[model samples]
Target: MAAPRSVEPADLSPLAWRLLRVAADYEQRTVEREIDDILQAHISMLENGSRALSPSRCNTLFALYSAELTEEQIRAIAENF
Candidate 1:
């Protein structure tokens, strides 16, 4: 089976795990420098959940991946951290 491209809230490393997948997907889709800035850390660290995303950065991600996601959804995602 293919690995999921988004993390579940109940996962052990919810924020980091979901951010990693979202970041990778964003990277693949665009050459935006902002995305580069967030993933400055090595991919290994990101994949392993050693790194977590900040709220401002999450705003950038939300803008890119799921612009239609509501503020309530964003808040819910934040609560996962």
Candidate 2:
């Protein structure tokens, strides 16, 4: 499965971008949440770098974007978070 890539925000880590993209997709498709607004909030939280994906949320995100990333990749990314 090919992953989504962003050219901008060169400072943003690959994992950060993928995690946020998956979160946004979940928010829009599964939860019926207000995606654009909530996505902004998620982005803000991640940009600070002090915050990391909690265990539960990380699992949920892995399930949602499973095609784009693997459990190993998720764990590797979470280690840096």
Candidate 3:
């Protein structure tokens, strides 16, 4: 049987860590109960690697953070891994 791969902090791309941090911050600041739940789910995806900061997901994250990011920047972040 193969051993599970170890995920080190250094193994995560800068963009992945950035997305995870921002999502965590948003979860902390959000006042809306329903949206907070959704944010938690997004955080789970990022931490578990089930989902990544793809262009579409990046757009959603940026919107959640109320931060503006260009498509090119988004693409760079998405493809960093």
lDDT of candidate 3 over 4-51, digit per residue (tens): 123233345545545644543545235234243345556566656676
Q: Candidate 2 deviates by what RMSD?
A: 9.2
Candidate 1 regions exceeding 4 Å error are 1-25, 28-36, 40-47, 68-81
What is the TM-score of each predicted model, taking all chains together?
A: 0.35, 0.34, 0.35
Give Cα distance to truth, residue 57, candidate 1, Å. 0.5
* Better structure of 2 and 3 per TM-score: 3
Write model 2 residue lDDT over 1-81, tens digit each, in one string.
Answer: 433332223334645645645643544334225322334445445545645555455344434454555545544454554
Q: lDDT tens digits, residues 1-81, model 1?
A: 222235332342544445544644644225245475654353335445676566565445545544434444444454565
Candidate 1 yields a Cα-based lDDT of 0.46
Each prediction's RMSD over C-alphas, in Å, is 8.8, 9.2, 11.6
Alpha carbon deviation, residue 61, candidate 1 (Å): 1.0
CA displacement after TM-score superposition, residue 64 of candidate 3 (Å)? 2.7
Q: List the residue pairs that clash in candidate 1.
A: none
> How many angstroms is residue 3 displaced in model 1 relative to the true structure, after the best TM-score fit?
24
